[model samples]
Target: MDDEARRDHRTVGDVDLTTWRTRAGRASASAWVRLGDRFGALPLLLVTLLIGIAIAAVCTWVASEVYDAVREADDVAVLDRPVLDFAMSLRTPGLDTVVTWWTNVAGTVGMPIVAVGFLVGFTIQRRAWTPLVLLVAASAGSLLMTVAGKDLIGRARPPLADAVPPYERSPSFPSGHTLNATVIVGTIVYLLLLRQSRRATRVWTVVLGSVFVVSVGLSRVFLGHHWLTDVLAAWALGLAWLALVITAHRLYLTALRRDGASDIHRPS
Candidate 1:
């Protein structure tokens, strides 16, 4: 046999089912599609990845510019006083008392709870450790990014109309509430989508997750802990990260399907 053929044969060493399953799941998505579908799906995946990347880049740039412009203003009065006034009004012990509770409690504890929930669900259903690994990776990555963002941007929070303590000394360019909301809520939503097959479950999960994210962002502003731009930037960053992760995850799943491990797609 030729040298290339010999090398190929050598690479075909025996592999355990578990190892093979992992190898397939971790295979390059574009390559898998090319091998499986005569390069047709490869082009589509590449195009989709490019489009996603472009959109994320545009959104990130826009968010940065918007936050910078907003931060340049020396006085709050420069913007319509009503905008700030409206946000201030929501801080009263009504209109959204639940929001206050959720925001305060969630910003403190909800993330851990959600993380545990995802872990339990994954263990019970798939019995695979990969989902847990992904969750931990997402959490660590987001936390580091948030700290780095705060340090780099260093935008100040708005002056409180009422007494609202700053729990953390950090920049206000990207709201931590928004960032955490994005990661916690977004991760939960992603995991739920992967696990649940019912259309209603998917719809409701999107609605609930969207509401949670938006509310947390607005709460940060209303509580006088962050500027509107901060929350907006958080959303931009969160969405960008979520898109990247999901796209990568999809590629991984596709590779798994290519292997004999067809059971990977059995309704989560």
Candidate 2:
């Protein structure tokens, strides 16, 4: 063929160049889409898991350091004692009442009710079993971790004289109330934000959850029931666990979507 005719035909060596390029581009796009559909959540899950592990390690280190200090009667423990004494010194009837109220609300009794209510409500509203399972697992796991950590560390609580009413005898390296509250409130906020689309609503949900978690942690110290480090460790540990739960749930949803499950709701 002449040069002009060859150009018009858009062919190279008897192969249609335009057609080949178009097909190649389409194939590349299709492969990318398929890859994304299959494994797009993998990177996020991996990154989250890594971060969770790092945070958990830091918490463990902190708890261990505190445990060592207490065991050896080190300076850390000496300083910690003054903080507890100060916390006790600030106590008044009204302040005690308010702190106790928060402690009660976020403590064993009130937290269980809140968790169960959320579990039942989410299960009923979403008509899904996975959420219920996820929440129950999170709560149970938190309880297990709290108990295990306390038993393992075996750190003593503040002196009875330093504490307010409603004293606890459990070992208190990491505050159970703080850890449990973090997980419970964090999970609830995660689930709520997942279903909510509005930015304002999500922001409010996060804010409220943060306040609840922080208040619960501070109440433990304010009541002289735990040292400041105990609450800090709980925050880190609870956050790590919370991150794993959230990552797992998102992964499950991603798998469901890939498997052609039409009823699965994507997180917002």
Candidate 3:
């Protein structure tokens, strides 16, 4: 036998290490794919459920902390002073106009229009039911969570005297604009990433997604509509929800692949 072949066949205590390792790696990958096909959703469901619980825990902690500080009249620099100062520091005619414009664009009326336009466009292009269902369900769930959070907390908005024009009356624990924008923009970005195989396109899509979410959240604070904690909590909650949506969709794709279904065609 040739030296190379003999070396490949050489056994270490009756086991060929190279061949064993090769088989082991392939077996592992195949098992993973099979698991994804047969039970792909269970893991995602469990992880998402845990994340939802963590989100709830975090929100509860923030609400409790804020409540304590208010009741005790303690000045907590971390929670209160820094963000307020930052907001106040940015006050100016030109920047105020710009930020206000952003808030309006990312707010209730504008974001919905953007989200619906993408939904319709993607649905028409892909001709798939999965994306439609995923978007609708995620949007509805986000709305419900936002409303419930505001109502439950019932925290007052920043003092009217300190706030900018066109003040909001809703609770300020979680920013609805932040939460909605995160879910909508995040999901759209995910869909876009799935459609594109190019590295540059994926990178840009992620960057744009981050910019959209961050901008909306910051605008809420800049306009004095939400506290920093409010925006932070909204981000955490929104991310948790986004993870769930992405996981569910991946599970669907895995199942489709397992069943020998044709892959969903993406526009180049």
Candidate 4:
């Protein structure tokens, strides 16, 4: 009935907490050693940091350009109303109902549930933490950007008169639904690809994931819940964050080499 006894009770991958911790500790130590031995920690870190900064800057610039275009009603903003109008023209009561249902999968309440489902399923299946760690990093950054962009830009949604009901109150420069869908779904797809072997299956998985992400973005414009520019910015921002997450994870894998983290992360 002490700390040692408590570790005996807890478990992961059929190993008790104590054993799991020891294995994880060893894997981590070995990974760092491999990293330092191969490239030296400082140099690798500097290289990764520079790449990350470049990716972030590009994404930020793209989003900001879209935001300005929308604000000034020129450039890409020129297409905003016409696209919305085309979407509106196609809107039937039946179509509206279906699109609304589809869009909600990426909405505030629904997206969290979707993320939790993936996290829980991955943990239970693999008994590993790598996917959750990477996915959470990707999502947390995207969520922060969504909130920050909304607040800073304070962009308005398309006129309520044009939108479907159950209206959202948040500022709408970057569509939260589109951004979350891009990052969360994208990361899931990427993690799955890491362990996937069948070429046919991998192709299908990527195709379906890409289609779903695009559909979610389109649904926002169709529902008049977000402008075309909002979805565009979200895509740019989400891709930016997702790229950073994947690059960082790849760097970790490079450091870990094939011995410890590679197999640990790719747990079958």
Candidate 5:
């Protein structure tokens, strides 16, 4: 759409490219609002971000520290029984095949599938830029955080010392599968809820999200790539990340309201 036509069509709740720019511009302006109306949101968002980082950092640090301590302790032998028992409980050939297939689906194709869906939203609404930016940011942010966490913790993988030809050589404090699944699925759900408020949409989003999160976490265990603790930590970290981002997005919306931009992003 041409600039003038786009601008003319933009409304307060719109989800098109122009509305996205309007929303972001409103957000930027709201960030710098001189009046006291927005004083609360900015600091609160910053604090939320800081708190998330702190939690992730502390958990990661503690995990690494504990791994070393346990490795050297005589009680290390005590852990083997429970770990083995847990692994045994998950040992079913049928489940393994299913998880293996789903794992491949989630990792190789799920993300791109989500991205393409987002692109459809962008195309239909002529808001190509907004979803594009949001998805790209989520993807980059998820990857960077996972890699950094892996490097920082430097925890060893599940000990398959002799059987594998080549194995993942990174820390396993938080499973990358857990991270990617949470972020990608979380982003899709969040965006869908943002754009559509129907009861069925909300219910389906919740159901789909719950299933994806649980299945992905379970797949990590079935694949023998992560300890239960690692998947748990990843879930915690992912939720914390999503909460911070949502908080920021809402704060930006509030800022826009305070900035006298009422007609900026209405859905057509």
Candidate 6:
């Protein structure tokens, strides 16, 4: 065996059925095709590992830049007040109640239920723990980011007076609601797509997930529970972490294909 082949053999096992499903799914994506074509079997995992690292670095850089601006209250941070004020102005007591209830349903409590339900349902359907593991990783990483951003920046939410009832006290530079929704919902859709081959289904899945994540972010702002910049940073940070997880899955598949896993092309 070549040095690279020997190295890959040591790094990961031959392809398993469930993970092979991910590889099968990616083969249909043009971007994934371009990415995979560049790698020979031996170096695929190594290259994927490098790609995941690059994604992490870019995400951290983007998040940090947003943080620095917010910390200094310049750049995009300058719009925080006006945007928030406009959101506040549009609210009436009825609207505040509606948005607040919806945010609650979509944010902290609701997201966990949806994630756990998805993990359980898919684990049953696929008879595989891969989806469960990914969900845990996505949820845990997002929660860690939320806590770290809150602690590191110690940025406060809008005054309780401006916010709807049942106010939050956490530091709010990056909205946990927005961050968690983006990571969890985004991960769910990606996994769902691995098993979905229909063009219309995939398109709708992407669209729905995007709307849900965006709604979560906007809800935080409308409720005056967070600033506009907080949600933007949350999305950028969430996307970075999601990239890391998905690429790690891709790396797993790359290892499998090296051992002769079949292409298993997407149906037309």
Question: Which one wins on lDDT?
Answer: 4
lDDT by residue (tens digit), candidate 4, 1-268: 3232221212222322122134664465455546656876435544554556456545655666566765676666678899999999999999999999999998888988988898898777666566677677677677777877787678888999999987887898789899999999998887777656677777888899999999999999999999998898889788878877765654444443434443444333
lDDT of 1 by residue, 1-268 (tens): 2231121111111312112234445354436544435644334444444555455445555666665665577443355245556776656566446556667745757777877887897767665554664566556555655765676667666764442454445677677778777876787687666556577877899999999889888777666677676777788788776766566445534533444433332322
Model 1: lDDT to the true structure: 0.60
Evaluated at residue 221, the lDDT of candidate 1 is: 65
Candidate 3 lDDT at 167 equals: 88
What TM-score against the true fold does each predicted structure earn?
A: 0.68, 0.72, 0.71, 0.75, 0.66, 0.74
Q: lDDT of candidate 2 vs native?
A: 0.69
lDDT (10s digit) by residue, model 2, range 1-268: 2231221212223332222134454453334335546665334434444555455555566667666766576645666777787888899999999999989988879999999998888878776566665677678667767876786788888888888888899898789899889988898887777666577887788999999999899899999899887888789889878977765554434332333322222211
User: Compared with the true structure, what per-residue lDDT tens digits does model 3 show for residues 1-268?
Assistant: 2231221212223322222134454353344446655665345334444555455445545655665566466543367557877788879989888888888877889988988999998878776555666677668657766876787677677777777888899787678899889888888887777667577877888998899899999888887888777788789888878876765554334332432222222111
Candidate 4, which segments miss by more than 4 Å at Cα? 1-62, 258-268
Higher-scoring candidate on TM-score, 1 or 3: 3
Give one digit per residue, the lDDT tens place, for model 6 in 205-234.
999999989988998999889989889888
The lDDT of each candidate is: 0.60, 0.69, 0.67, 0.72, 0.59, 0.71
**Runs in model 5 with CA error above 4 Å?**
1-84, 126-128, 161-167, 258-268
The candidate 5 region of ten consecutive residues with least summed lDDT is 4-13
Whichever of 2 and 5 has more TM-score, that candidate is: 2
- CA RMSD for every model? 10.8, 14.5, 11.8, 9.4, 7.9, 8.4
TM-score of 4: 0.75
Write the residue-wise lDDT of candidate 5 on 182-258 in tens digits: 87678777766665646687778879887988888877665667776677667876776666565444443443343
lDDT of 6: 0.71
Checking candidate 2 for backbone clashes, the offending pairs are none
